[model samples]
Target chain A: MIRDITIGQYLPGNSVLHRLDARMKAVLTFFFIIVIFLCKNFWSLGLMIAFTLLFTAISKVPLRMMLKSLKPIFVILIFTAVLNIFYTDGGRELFGFWKLSVTDKGLYTAGFMVIRIICLITGSSLLTYTTTPTLLTDAIERLLSPLKVFKIQVNTLAMMMTLALRFIPTLIEETDRIMNAQKARGADLESGGFIKRAKALIPILIPLFVSAFRRAYELAFAMECRCYRGGEGRTRMKQMKLKARDLGAAFLVAALFCGVFFLNYRFKALI
Target chain B: MNENIIEFNNVSFAYDSEIVNAPAVVKNVTLSIKRGSFVAVLGHNGSGKSTLAKLCNAILVPQTGKVTVNGMDTADNGLTFDIRRTVGMVFQNPDNQIVATVVEDDVAFGPENLGVEPKEIRRRVDEALKSVGMYDYRLFEPHKLSGGQKQRVAIAGITAMQTECIVLDEPTAMLDPRGRLEVMETVKRLNRELGITVVFITHFMNEATQADRVLVMDDGGIILDGTPKEVFSHKEIIIDAGLDLPAAAEFSDMLISDGFNLPDGILTAEECIEAIYAEAKKRGVC
Candidate 1:
């Protein structure tokens, strides 16, 4: 059951999007998100959708897997759609109720929001689906290096992030082992109230925490044994260099941003 | 210059030296590891074997005496980095040692920390991985690897640092039999082919038999230290140290008591087999 998580999952591929620089992909994803929000009408939203789908297709990640990334956010999507349908007002009223009314504007707004959200999720997940988490964190470190002027420990933060990403699967496995051990000892974690179930997790949590601390202690020694003395004077094996493909990707995203802005201005605004 | 890669001069350490009269974990242990020799340390739990391994690389500085790695004193604060770089260490738990998600990146971590150029780090990473027979799994996630494979990768991490000596603190303890064999073979190759000095701490008698020299620790002191054959020959001392002999040695010792003229110090199965075959021929028995 714990294995179902797809966050930070990378599908190995050699597509153009996959080969794009991680820093460029990250920047473009940020810009694409802003463009999605800047979208003022269905025409612009539709263009954003097309842009997202085109990149997804270029990434060569399976469509089903991309959709699977949305499964965890399904509840939020539905909640937003419902709230917009009932709360938003304007245009001709289509249905009426005691306190809430559905109008054409409300329906249009709900459709726009749902589509906008779908595009936002798919666009960002595309970056993760193509690039390994290591590259993404490396990109983050380099991108945030400028913030060092503010006395920020950007390198330490990035190292922490990398370590967190590296240990997620390991800790999950540890949790699974602890849970199974508790189960074997006749601990009732399955059949109980919410509070009771949470109480039952105490047995699992204690061991997990203990083992995690032990792991941390050993890991510190191991890192030191490897001559790690913080990020100062440290060089990376994989250097992030911007290639022609990165520029090409940037140009493509820029084109999408312009098209969205043009459509937002050229047509009548709809909300 | 001394031929020893590591020298311990009456080194003693305690986890709680702040307390009045805290018992030392390592008690005045004076030892030297030769530049290219393979030394295995055998002891039960809480016997200071791990402490000795830590002292080699300055992970734990000696409280009473001194430890020198490649002729540099570990007790000196400024030389700690250089000491660690000279004597790389692989801990018992493989999962805890890996710093990178991917195998190649984890192996590159040491060289990266030492500020080697990117191209050299890549070259060393590839060479280290290939030497450990893990080049095929360079792109693989470390969590997906078997215990032995992860341990080998940990060794490769140390190998990439190009350290002259590697101290493994019970590397095969968490592995299955096959995993143990794989790690042992990889370690053997690294020692024999690459000429890396190894200080392996393990309780497995069979593994100790393969080492060029073996040290038996008891209550934070070296009780026995000699060549594997010379060390295992003292059966009473070994049994009294709360350790067992290798299976071949035990069987051969029993056969000798039964009047089969087997030679002493049969530490491996092949040696026992050859001895028994020669005995049968001399006795005119098939």
Candidate 2:
């Protein structure tokens, strides 16, 4: 059951985005989201769509995967469009049925909102899809190092993230092993109602929790033996270094934001 | 004995149910293993060899009596970490003990956790990997490695910690023939070339032949302890414990039963061949 959920999991490829510093990608994504929120009207929305499409193409991520990520949000998207279209009573009232009144302005907002949301999901998924979670967390730590002035333990957080990522596959593999073991003992996990199914998970859950604790204890001991005291003077094999292209990426995103923000004020004010 | 690296005295451990005595999992076991020696402990599935290995480094403290390593009591909570470092453990399932995704990282994990300097860790990690001949696979993910390579990496992990002795519990249980051979060869190399005290727990009698001393356990207690030849000579004791003698040992015994006066205490294929040749020389049959 855990194996099929591959939404934010990275797909390895030789793409420019994949090669970019993790810190840069994270910062750019934040600014892009801001730009997305400020977008208004057809030209701005079209620009956002074109930019995201260009990102998707460059990431070399399969279109099928992006579509898969949008599957769970499909219901929310439909509801959002419907609510915005029918409930708004601004501009020209084009249709009226029962208590519902469709307006021209409402249509425009609804259309733009849907486009913005779709773009937002795709753009964010692109970040995770290109970079492995460990590198992503490392990038986050480097980016957040300034918070050390507040005495924040960035390395600790990064370590936690790395450990979590490292264990995801391990835990999934463990769960599968335990399920198979239980099934061998004639534990029927299938063909049960909600309560029975929930109860059946006990065998798997108890073992998983127990093993997780065991692993944690062993890891602690093992780490201590290796002289892992804490996040003090640790060096990494693959250092998270920024290149000229990283700065260029930030500048490019800044330009995109400026253009998007100006269009929002100018276009919306005239309208 | 150069030094008694491991000492167990009247140690008994039980799950502590209502039952009395209950044939303690490790019953009244008193034994001392010398440093820089390769010792193999053999038994069937329920013979408690694994329990003994765990007690060596205080993975599970004895319910009664004590286990001490190099004068440090395993029961000493303060020295527990030090004791664990002094004697590292490699379990049967390589998948269960690995903490890192990458091979070199997994090896470095031990020294890194021990709070060694980054440069020192890098040096030890490289040396440990080279010791096991796996330096080339430094960057590879552990899951991508073969069973033998994974086990080698696990050994490298302990080696990098600079543990003087390593307790390996059925380390080749999950491996194929080639993998099992690879692991056994690595264990022997670590014991002889590196002069690391090795306490190996295994079911395979052939693998146990490489050890300096062979200890057989049955019903949660040591049944026999001696040199491999002296230990394997007790065929009846081994068969009663539901474990077999090494094939070469068996072949030697078979020749003796067939009315050939082959000398006893044969422990390997080469030894059996040499024994047959000696008999042929006596009879001018060679």
Candidate 3:
């Protein structure tokens, strides 16, 4: 059941989007979020939505999995929509009650908020679904390399991120194994009151923590054995290069940004 | 470039530096591992065999005398990296050692750390993976691999570094029977084909039988060191070292004690079988 949580999971593929340099994808994803928020009307949002869907289709990410990524934020989406409807009061009142009212503007704003949230989740999900976790770490490290000028240990931080990402599934599997072993020995982990359940987890958590620390020590030793000395003077095996496709994608994003800016201005002038 | 890849000059080490009176984990160990030789270190748990492996790579610098690898003293701070690169160490836990998610990337890790060129690293990664018979699974996640395959990948990680020697501290300890065989065969092939010096630290007597030389440790010191035949011949010392003999040796000992003719220091099942067959033929039972 824990494995079904695929929000941050990468589905391996050879699609053009998947092959894009991770740094390019990361930068575009950031700018894409900005474009999503810069819109003031349905026209710009529609453009962004179309762009997301087209990219999603080209990337070959399963639409079902993409929707699953939005499941956790579904409640927040509704909350935002409800909050906008109840709080915002503006042009063309549609209905009214004591201390509460719904207006045409409120309805429009609520719908716009929902669409924005959906676009945000889907756009970011596309990034993860296309790029492997290691590539993502490399992309983040490369993008954040400028912080080195501020005396930041960018390489160390990036190496830590890469290790963390590499170990997530491993730790998850370990946790699952521990849970099963505890359950087989008559540990009541599933059936209990809240406090009782939390207490039952102690048996699993203790060993898990102990093993995790041991693993950390062993991994550190192994890393040292491989001559890893603080990542100084280290060269990367996989180098990220910006290719023609990345430039084309960047060009498309720039055009989208310009379109959103124009539409946001044009719509405001009319309003 | 030295014929002797690793040398320990009266080395002593301990885990807790605060305990000055505590016995060292590796006590006054003096040894040299020749280049392109397969040497097995045998001892039960807590016999300081693992500590010996660590000392070779400078992971745990000896507290007393000096340990050197490829003529670089492990005690020298700046030489630590070079020592490690010259003598790679693979631990028992496969999952803990593999740093990268992808097999090929993990294999490239050591070379990358050593500052190899990207293209050369790629070539080495592929070559290492192919050597370990995991080339087809290069892009696969490490966690998804079998225990044996994961250990192979770890070995590949060392191989790609172009290390002259690899110290496997019970690499097959966590593996199943098949996994153990797979890892053992891989290590042997690496030694025989590539002429990479191998220091296989294991408690398994059968494993020790395969090595060119076996060293038995007890109480943090080497008690016996010789070829498999010479080492297994002294049954009392092996038992005193907290180790059992290979099954063939024990069986041969039993047969000889039962007034049957059998060769001493039998180290393999096939050898035992052949001895039994010859005895039967001599008695006209065949």
Candidate 4:
């Protein structure tokens, strides 16, 4: 069960979207999210949804998997949908209850909120699905590198992130091994009360922490032995360049932004 | 002007000097490894063989005398990076030593740290991976590789740094027999083909037999030092160091004890077989 937590979630492919620069994907994803928020009417929201679907289609990740990725956020989606449905009373009532009414505006707002949330998740998931975690973090590091002028340790922060991501699978495997070892010793982790389960975790947690610390120390020694001196005068093996497709991707996002603005203006005039 | 790639001069170190008052993990040990020579250090668990390797790379600064790599003093803070770059290190645990998720990136780590140009790093990474025969696995995530493959990648990491020497602290201690053989083969190939100085610290008796010289440590000091033949000849000293003779050597000793005239320190299967054949011919038994 611990293995199901896919932190990187990258699916390797040879498509154009997968070939775009990670910074391009990351920037466009951020831009797309802000565009989602700017949608003020159904037409603009429809255009935003169209853009997201186009991205999802280009990514070629199975629709079912994309929806499955949203499972963790299902509760938030439902909660917001229900709140918007019951609250907001600015139009004709569709239903009535004790001091409660479902108006047309509330229904529209609820639909828009649900669509916006879904689009937001799918768009971001597309970015992660196409770009490996290392590349994604590298893009972030490069984007935030300007903070170095202010004496921020941006490189160290990025290194820590990359290391954290690199070790997640290893730690998960360790946790699974420790849990099984404890289980073999007849530790009752299942079929227990809440506090009992929490208490039962101590054996696993202690060993896990001990092993993690041991690994951290060994890793630090290894890093130091390789002449790691706090990000000074370091070069990278995989260099990221803004290729033609990346520029095209940026242009596509710009066009999407303009299309959303035009649709919002037209819809406001009609309303 | 010393021809020695690594020199240790009366060095000693302890983990916790203030509280425990225990003996140093590494004691007054003076040794020098010639350039392009394959040297193996053998000892039991607490014999400080690993500490000696760390001292060579300046990971553990000596408490008394100094360690010099390529004529730079390891104790000098300014030359720490230079020492590390001159003498690379591969630790026992392959998993902990790997710094990158991707195999190629991990291999590129050392060269990258050295501030090599990006183009040069790419070329060196490719060359190192190919040298270790892990070029095909350059794109694979490290967690997906086997123990042998990971160690090879770790070696590739050091190789990409273009270092003149590599110090492996029981690199095969945690590996399976097959993985051990794979790593040893890679180590030998690097030493032979690239003329890279190798300091292999291991407890495996058979592993020491392959080296040009073997140093046996007992209680943080060198107890035996010679060619494998010369060192394995002193069976009592090796045993006293809490190590066994190579299996072939033990077998040859068995034959000798049974009144056979086999020579001492027969280290390989073929040599043991030839010795038995020679004894049988001398007895006129075929």
TM-score of each: 0.95, 0.82, 0.94, 0.96
Candidate 3 lDDT:
0.90
The segments of candidate 4 whose C-alpha lies over 4 angstroms from its true place after superposition are A1-6, A269-271, B19-21, B278-286
> Tens digit of lDDT per residue, candidate 4, span B128-221?
9999999999998888888999999999999999899999999999999999999999999999999999999999888999999999998999
lDDT of 4 by residue, A81-160 (tens): 88998887578888899988998888888888989999999999999899989989899999999999999999999999
lDDT of 3 by residue, A1-271 (tens): 6544332588979999999999999999999998888888888887888898989999999989899999999999999999998888666888899989998888889999999999999999999999987888889899999998998999999989878877887789889999999989999998879999999999999999998999999999999888888768899988888899999999989999998888777776212
Candidate number that wins on lDDT, 1 or 4: 1
Of all native A–B interface contacts, model 1 reproduces a fraction of 0.92
Model 2 lDDT tens row, B1-286: 3389999989988866458866688899999989999999999998999989889887788878989899888898888778888899888877666766668878877776666777787889999999988999998766667788888999999999899999998989999999899889888898889899999999999999989999999989999999988888788999999999899988888889999998878888998898899999999997
Write the residue-wise lDDT of candidate 3 on B170-232 in tens digits: 999999999999999999999999999999999899999999999999989999999999999
Chain B alone: TM-score in each candidate? 0.98, 0.95, 0.97, 0.96
Q: Which digits, one per residue and each the tens of the lDDT, describe model 1 over residues A135-231?
A: 9999999999999899898888988988998889889989899998988989999887999999999999999999999999999999999999887
> How many angstroms is residue A126 displaced in model 1 relative to the true structure, after the best TM-score fit?
1.6
Cα TM-score of candidate 2? 0.82
True contacts preserved, each candidate?
Answer: 0.92, 0.20, 0.86, 0.84
lDDT of 2: 0.84
The clash tally of candidate 4 reads 0
Top-DockQ candidate index = 1
lDDT of 2 at A9: 75
| Candidate 4 chain B: 10-residue stretch with minimal lDDT | B14-23
Best by TM-score: 4
Candidate 1 error regions (>4 Å) = A1-7, A82-103
